[model samples]
Target: MDSHGSSNGLREEEIDAVAMAVIAVVVNTMADKESSSCNMLMRLRQRRALLQSVAEAPDCAATCEAVVQLCVALTSGVFPRLTPRWWIKRRTGGTWEDLRLRDDATDEYFRQKLRMSTTMFNHIVAACAAYMEKKVTHYRMPLPVEQLIAFALYRWVSGETYESGTSAFGIGRATGLQAFRDVISALLQAYPDAIKWPMGRRRAQILRAFREKGFPNCFGAIDCTHIYIDKPAGAPSENYYDRKQKFFVQAQVVVDLDLRILDVHVGYPGSVHGVRVLHNSQLFRRAESGELFDATPENLPHYVVTRGYLLGDNGYPVACPWIVSPYGGIDQGADEERFDTRQKVARGCVERAFGRLKCMWRLFLRTHKTNLETLPQQFVVVCTLHNILLDTGMDFDENLL
Candidate 1:
């Protein structure tokens, strides 16, 4: 019994020792947590005191003002303030000024530079001046109408880079581009009927000219030419790739014997055939409905033809009554061969017109770099200008061609 009681006493002693160790650990952990809490509180109080001192300091407002000014100065040095309308005052005196001073003495030079006679230039300027005029602004004086017209003409005819062209005109690149666009718009607006279908005396004159060329009741020559252009963004590039492995847009035109464009349809893809392009045009629609010419049939030597027809190459449909395409295949007889020769000569008008148009503008000779959507309008404007130049009896430098 004494042995068991001693064992129990020993166990009780061990339990007491264990309880003392656990209480010591708990007290230490609580003390450590309390110390950490006090330290955090003291730090927070110190930060509050610092903030209060800064707020209450006598020079704090001045300090902030100084800091703000310093920031402003730094920013000013880093990024200078931009002017509302910045421009350089360029000195005016170039080929344009020389031509203006010499006036009629420089008529040939004027025609060479702008592809128009001085009189025609003045006439165009007069017609477009009202539309081209800009209100005088405090920022700068508006460019003169004559200057604008001359710059536009020079740019269009020369196809010079904007940097060089603008430099020649003493204008900014943006200003030069805007001037060209404005001039084009003004021309289109002023001469809406510049490319209209022949009527009354004009129709009779066109018919007479073609009759002299051995094609009776022929209205015009129809053909298509590719206008090279950069592949348009967001459009299928393959659609514009042509047989020459170049990107282009097709323009179908009908021209009288004088090489005056009577009708034009532009903006078809380069890969599209001339027949397809023609079929989709208003010209085809009018011809199909017999609205393009009188339906009265005219007797040819071998055939009776109704509706004035357009002469086209063999690429166009010979099946259509409104169009006369050259005889194809090697088995053609003498009569057919002779007719083909005359037809080819008549068709040459459209080809020559295209050549002259491209040669004069020169812009169309290179791949166009402007927006594709504006191309049709630009082409129409050029064609109108071509007709106007022709009407004025402006001489083309065949040497340039």
Candidate 2:
């Protein structure tokens, strides 16, 4: 009986050694094939079959049970089951992508889709790419800068709903909206000086252009327009209600003869008059301090001498010589009538500038449904884009007017 028991003890020792060796081999195999869960499971199953065959022999049941339990613990819960990382198969062959591949696509096509020439669009992409770039992550790659710009331009020009716009770009609505805001911020940062007031040679050119239009020493035309918005939540909504029975904020713009926006002041409530809006602008303060233009008086016909001035409508106060307004009141002499007529012609530049602005960027044509606080930044961004396009000599289609 002692010899039989000793033989069983020797058998148990051999089985314990076998279990340890198998565990080491399985661990090494799992480490080598860590990336593939399927392979690890297959190896585990093969090893379990081999162990069970060994357990079929005499006096190895208890040791085999212990080995199986250890293997089960290692395979079941010792290591986390790594789910294969994946992304939803989004539609990549969308409008912007297709436009990029089509050889026949023209500047006109780009203008129709993006409200700018292809060259201008590419220029904007180049300028804003640095600000729009994002870091890559383990889950997914960042979107291309061109895609973000195209999505923003499409949304701005088309004035479509976020759902429709996102569908066109094969992105979710929230993603598209966030992309639009990011692009706007990128533009604001990339082109900070795009809408600056002209100086030196540029100012001289603007004066010459206005002089040809029969207004001497004129810098630009200034006016105010309403940018409609939804009812405000914090501010007094009544202050935003305009004469047109719409809630809006006002934008005061100074435009050159070519309808390029030179300076802009936005965010005043629509109920405020143009004169009051002007009073609150930096332009007004600069003009008041005689720092905005050359203060030397230039002589005109009929002994009318004045410095560089902006032509405005009757809505502005004529208290300052720099801000020239049309002669008001019905009973006017022929000379005053002629002066008013010429002033109207030259000041029409501002009106046409507003028209082109709304036509090109139709986002302003509708009541703004997004955050009210962001409207001012968006306004400045659009104005900057407008100046950039003009600087590139890319004019909007006249037929669109």
- Give each model a TM-score: 0.75, 0.76
> Compared to the true structure, candidate 2 yields what TM-score?
0.76
Please report the candidate that would top TM-score against the real structure.
2
Clashes of each: 0, 0
> Pick by lDDT: which candidate is best?
2
Q: Which stretches of model 2 miss by more than 4 angstroms?
A: 1-93, 301-304
Cα lDDT tens digits, model 2, 1-401, are: 35876567436567667766766755654452243578557656766765665544455565566567656755564333232334333555377766576456666678888878777888899999899889743334466788888988887788777777788887777778789889989999899889888887888888889889887788999999888878888889999997678999989999998888988999999888878888899998988887888835778887988778998888777676778898878999999999899989889999999998998889898886756777888888888888888878775688877
Error of 2 at 260 (Å): 1.1
| Per-candidate local distance difference test | 0.76, 0.79
TM-score of 1: 0.75
Error of 2 at 386 (Å): 1.5
Question: How displaced is residue 266 in candidate 2, in Å?
Answer: 0.7
